[model samples]
Target: MQVRNRQRLTLPGCSSSGGSSGGSSGGSSSSDNTLAAVGMTKNQFRCVFNPSTNRDVLGRANTAAMIDKHWTQFTSAASQLNFRFGNLDEAAVFFGMVRHEYGGYLDDMRENCARQGVACRQYDTCRQGGNNYYGRGPLQISHCYNYEAMSQYVGVNLRSNPNALLDANNNLGWRASIAFWTRPEFNCQGTWEAVRAFPTCPAAARAGNIAAVSQRINGKVECNQNPRPANQDNRVSWIQNVRTSCFGLPRLTSNLYC
Candidate 1:
């Protein structure tokens, strides 16, 4: 019900594509300048794009060229947020936490759209209001109702411009994601308490607490079973890689989830 002017969607914590891929004034170096233009620091840029990992979430080898080629688009989208992450920890934890899942979701949605002719029938929400709402954006937003709500929140009129979510240049992809994250109603628990302040300064940033945070984002505990959920495992791995390899942070030793 509440739309427009929501705390500027400020995030004290929480926290990117190849080439111009689309919407860029220059090449890789130009892409780097864009981040600075948007007020993102060099360290913040590295945490988001150059994770210093061997392989990305899709299992492709991670390389500087790959970063040069793809991260520009991702950074473009993520930079739409008006707020800045407080530190490297906040930025790395958030970027790592979401990169795999959202990146995977975008791929899946594109495949579904290709096969289903612009609409995915598997999700009932996609059929609402006769809008053929397929999952789009980093968070893979589906459901016509949700689309309309997001349009209002982002001031993009997504109900009519739903495909804009797929347009990295428009920055709608990340906009929809941040909107969903800050809103408590989007989660099954009616609040994303996991992202709030905890006994520690960065409670959710700790790897042990990743499962709890994932559960909040996923609305369920995914990695607790004998065979961990593929999505859950991917996200956990992403966090681990970013923390150790990219940020050079200590390993999260707690086994919060088996």
Candidate 2:
């Protein structure tokens, strides 16, 4: 499943910095990189600057290539959303969701729509010369209620034409994700909040189950207040689970939980 990297506990020149670490992993390419696997269900491997050659570790071989092709879009969208959120926990959660939503392919969603007969029908009398049926955009913001909101927000007349899902330039790729970040329909219906900074999240910083702690943090802020999935994705790893990830403490300068 996940092809992991060779483990070496000793980090390079890692001094007792307050929160940052100095360890490095060796990899010729990004695809060949190793991820911190089998622990935090959330992909928690430290990012390496080299090109990736490690495919299995990231659940796909061409991940680096794909990200490279699309990272600009991702980063740009993330930049806007982060400004709104003002929190790193939120940022990481968005990262995970983006990876999950379209396999990072803003265009791949077209395939999903094609499968659902979105491009194949005719209509008369309903509105917009009939409508398509595929799920729309990165957030799967299906149905009229959701789409209408997005259309209004975007100032587009999607109510009439309805073929806007495939456009890569518009905000649907990223904006829609943020719009639905914690809607009741998603896996946790919880907007992924950034992990509290060290000291702010000491228990979580030291613990193994990072996901649970992150959950606790968002839960405190009502980001995760909706109904959860039946068999949920494990929120975090053992170390991440050990600490409380709540962002409500004082000195917390985060953008979320406001």
Model 1 quality (TM-score): 0.60
| Over 4 Å off, model 2 | 1-66, 78-84, 110-129, 169-171, 182-231, 234-258
Q: Per-residue CA lDDT of candidate 1, range 1-258, in tens? A: 110110111111212221112221224344443435433434333434433322223433334444443445545544664544454454555656555444332222232343344434543444445455655655566667677777765678877777777663445666676666544445412433643322221335433466555655553345346677555556666666555544545657664343
| CA shift of 29, model 1, Å | 8.2
Superposition error at 65 for model 1 (Å) = 9.7
Model 2 C-alpha lDDT per residue in residues 34-135, reported as the tens digit of each score:
221211211122221112322222233234343343434444544554524324343334333233333223344432325343453222223544564334
- TM-score to true structure, per model: 0.60, 0.42
Per-prediction count of colliding residue pairs? 7, 37
Best by lDDT: 1
